[model samples]
Target chain A: MLRAAGDWTTASIGDAERAIANVVRQARGVKQLNIAGLGQLDTNGAMLLLETAELAGEGQAVALTGVRDEHRRLLEVIAAASVRHTDAPDDGNPVLRVLAEVGETALKLAREGVELLSFSGAATMAIVGLALRPWRIRWRGLVTQLQATGLNALPIVGLLNFLIGVVLAYQSANQLSKFGAELLTVDSVGVGVLRELGVLITAIIVAGRSGSAFTAQIGSMRVNQEIDAMQTIGLDPIEVLCAPRIMALMITLPLLVFFADVMAILGGAVASMFALDITLTQFAKQLQAAVSINHFWVGIVKAPVMAVMIATIGCFHGLKVSSNAASVGQRTTQSVVQSVFFVIAVDAIFSIFFLIIDV
Target chain B: MTSDIPASTHPLAIHVRGLRTQFGSHVVHDDLELAVRRGEVLGIVGGSGTGKSVLLRTIIGLNRPAAGEIEVLGHLTGTGGAAAAKAIRRRWGVLFQDGALFSSLTVAENVEAPLREHSNLSPRLRREVAELKVALVGLPPDANDKYPAELSGGMRKRAGIARALALDPDILFLDEPTAGLDPIGASNFDLLIADLQKSLGLTVVMITHDLDSLYAICDRVAVLIDKKTRIDTIPELMKINHPWIQEYFGGPRGRAAIASAERAGAAV
Candidate 1:
């Protein structure tokens, strides 16, 4: 006869397993096991007892007596589960899995492209409708978004452009001085800063800062079902949520680009004064003579386009977020990455067009 | 009434005395004394803002009481050092409202978290035990690899239970386990808890407003009213004449739950 006693939970399984092993070894000739004295039993404990019974002998079926109904059911569950060996299927063929993943990603990207187009169309219609009914515009929401996406982004954008301008002027001075044409450094700085680096860097920074913020904010609202509540209350989410943000970005991004151009030129002037021994007045005069307003216009022209792309991508990914906390983080990252990528791609296309048409 | 201990050889799973919890002068529980015996299902019920969930959190050391003594499974819960508190925490598991699963992990990995934290089991065996727990909770085998977001509300709840039972805890604390479940699903969950409790000899402390669960599986019901607790069996509680208890136990939903339990041949 064998009696299982005391608690048999996982917390005490180490001692319980040892005790059960000793009991099973001694119970080789025993035919009955009594669980009547078993104070507490869990799945692990029950599994141990079942194994002991099996180890008692092959053909000698040990009868478990004094078994409570609940314990009996538990033992039965463990017994059934043990017999059915259901292992998760292995990932077959590493090459095939990689190919499959690539294919799936491509399909996902194609679907996203279509969705983005439709979203852009809807946003355009909303802007036109709001233009027709000027009073329908949410001025308060527009001002709030302006402060968040525009004013709050000023310091980082200004500082980053300033650093870029200083680096460019220093690097160009080295090569220009070799030919005794150090004054040509002003042309390089003016053209590079105003026509390319200033606006491009500003756009990338805004994409990372404001784009991810949009996704996180709207994704959280979607998670909490606030978006659904808005629709149910007969408010067009596009007009109320997307339009204000888009309009604010469109209006503020151009202004930000103009400010970035000024800061970068100021940085270049300071660098020229320090590195090339050029006076500040001479640097300013050369910069004003070398940089055409056409170059500044070219950079400012890309601002609204980059702004629209970033805002649309951010809000689109946000709306695509499923009702999971994890999805918000994932979508926010996607928003920033996609917005920056598209901004650079569009800027490249614009550069080619400008060169072809001799802007 | 304040210090009466049960005259049993086995210590109570939870013993509370002179519990006072307050938030900015909003008293939640005052002089709240309660005891939960070993191997019993205790259901805590109260209206909204009555501090039922707060009491559960307080006991689990997530929220500190303003003044009280809380002893859980013979360990002073909140008064201990970090290692001591961790040891006590390992002896119990808590299931939060809304399942509160780690959204990043699959169901199987979620169940394996405590095992990995506390035991030296190899990865294979830990995974095997996790699969066994998932099976025990009646989840489909395929759910092992699925994220919490991919599962329905009831399935998520079951996954949460599987994770809570990962370390084979002696005490299981659940917060509104069946709040978003349908009637059949709720009753099934109740049945599962009852079955698990009986098999494991678990001490379950659940905060719920589900009358069906109270009628079906709870061995004792603790009602919080007027900032204190009143603990009694279902029948004993039904006889109490307090206005809140009267309306609660004798209400239409309560009566319907009782009738269903009777039909199912449960001794109410």
Candidate 2:
């Protein structure tokens, strides 16, 4: 028995070509060239082995020794159309063969599932840790969120609220003036700004800005493999990277909400000053009187909760994204839309509960 | 070019028996046995899927062997005592294929990690030691403060070498150390290795396909074929009559080494 010994490598294209050349030149003198010990041979390597045998003039078979199942399979594939390495002795064991095939399939499924779970779990843990930490002074993750979602977010949030306020004031003013009921415009504007429109418009604006931004940043980091790299270096990707950002947004979002309310009110106040023939001060007083501190504080409280929720969700999805660059863009968009939807849904629930409690 | 323990006159460093490593149902390293002596360079050459990396990982205790006895440097590995396994690792240096330097840490910190983790050296002394090792690898002392990303590929590899030598390990493992380096860089690195081994009396185990390296650095080599490593000294390996050898040494690299040895014989 030939005691199999030594290393192996897959022959390269050049190696295969050379083998073919060697066989062509010496085919007449050889019986079978015993093939063994080449690992990771490519298609070119297979082709060369095949060509070598085919060109081996006549009456020659390349006897393959130490043929690993993979090698034998590859040889069979290459030799399907060409003649080479013809003699592969099979020590048949169906059970072993079935085990190998089934085991590979199971391993693949398990590996993929574990990787998916790893992504989701790691991302969720990072975001939850960030959101739950008390990094803001006002417990005002809400207030800061108002800022990011609403304050530094002002120009965009303000711009959007301005359009909404303008549209509301214009349409309502035109309809009321038709009946010479112009004075009732103050009542319409005051109640509308207080009960729902102001907070609703502002919250939507905040969601689009802060929520989406969070996702993009985290998603890109995921794409770059920085998270995995962090794990390898014994650094907590959440503590070192995500928490501070989440904390910053918490600080930013409530202030964002406060700014959004201002812009939205300004939009309504401007229309009141003009359309209702009420002075800015009178409009302000009327607006303030109509919506109690309860209404304002209620909306205000939702800012931080909303911020935490949006930031958490954004970071979670971003971190959960796949390694590919395309995943970042896709997840970022999803994060923005999902955050906006969740924020509105949560806000509505809170509003209904608070109103019910007050009533 | 330099003497590291008077050529290959070192004691045995690694011993293994009945080693087997499997991935799922596929057995990669089966009933493998090999021993490597200290104070000599042992080269490992293998075909793909022959479990070369698997064998190395098992011997180093990074991956557990399905069935085997591994005694590295007089210590049985894979026992429940993590401290002992870690101490064994602390006494050995490994340079992975891509250097595997911490990207976040400066070169100095990466080198200092093992020292900080295992040694009792003060911070100042550790920094000094790191600088010295960096300089020994022919890197500038300033290279220590630069992140792994700042350095070129060759520089990173050198930095990895510097870090590996930080603990003054008795055994050094280099996996594809010259895989991506230019010929000049690779040759210089080889010379650096020779000098370091000679001066430190280090036992080096290098895995490579570079035939020139086999002739240049290896005192012995093992062919990982047939699911186990069959090691032979360079002189004995040169005369090996096997199918793998027919394709390997019979190829350019093996041929070149033989021709060079003949030339040296003529010169002698």
* Top-scoring candidate (TM-score): 2
TM-score of each: 0.54, 0.57
Per-residue lDDT of A11 in model 1: 83
Q: Which residue pairs come into collision in candidate 1?
A: none
Candidate 1, residues A202-294: lDDT per residue as tens digits? 999999998998899888777754454333222467887889989999998999998899888888888999999988899888878877889
Q: What is the interface RMSD of candidate 1, in Å?
A: 16.2
lDDT tens digits by residue: candidate 2, B75-185: 677764755555566667877766767665699987886776667789999999999999999998789889988999889888888878987888888887888888888
lDDT of 2 at B206: 90
Off by over 4 Å in 2: A1-359, B1-12, B15-19, B57-71, B74-78, B81-89, B113-123, B238-241, B261-268
Which residue window of length 10 is worst by lDDT in model 1 chain B? Answer: B1-10
Alpha-carbon shift of residue B220 in model 2 (angstroms): 2.6
Query: Please, what are the lDDT tens digits per residue for candidate 2 over residues A167-281?
Result: 6777778899899976566567655654566666666665677667767766766665445433322345555555555666666666755666677667876886777777888
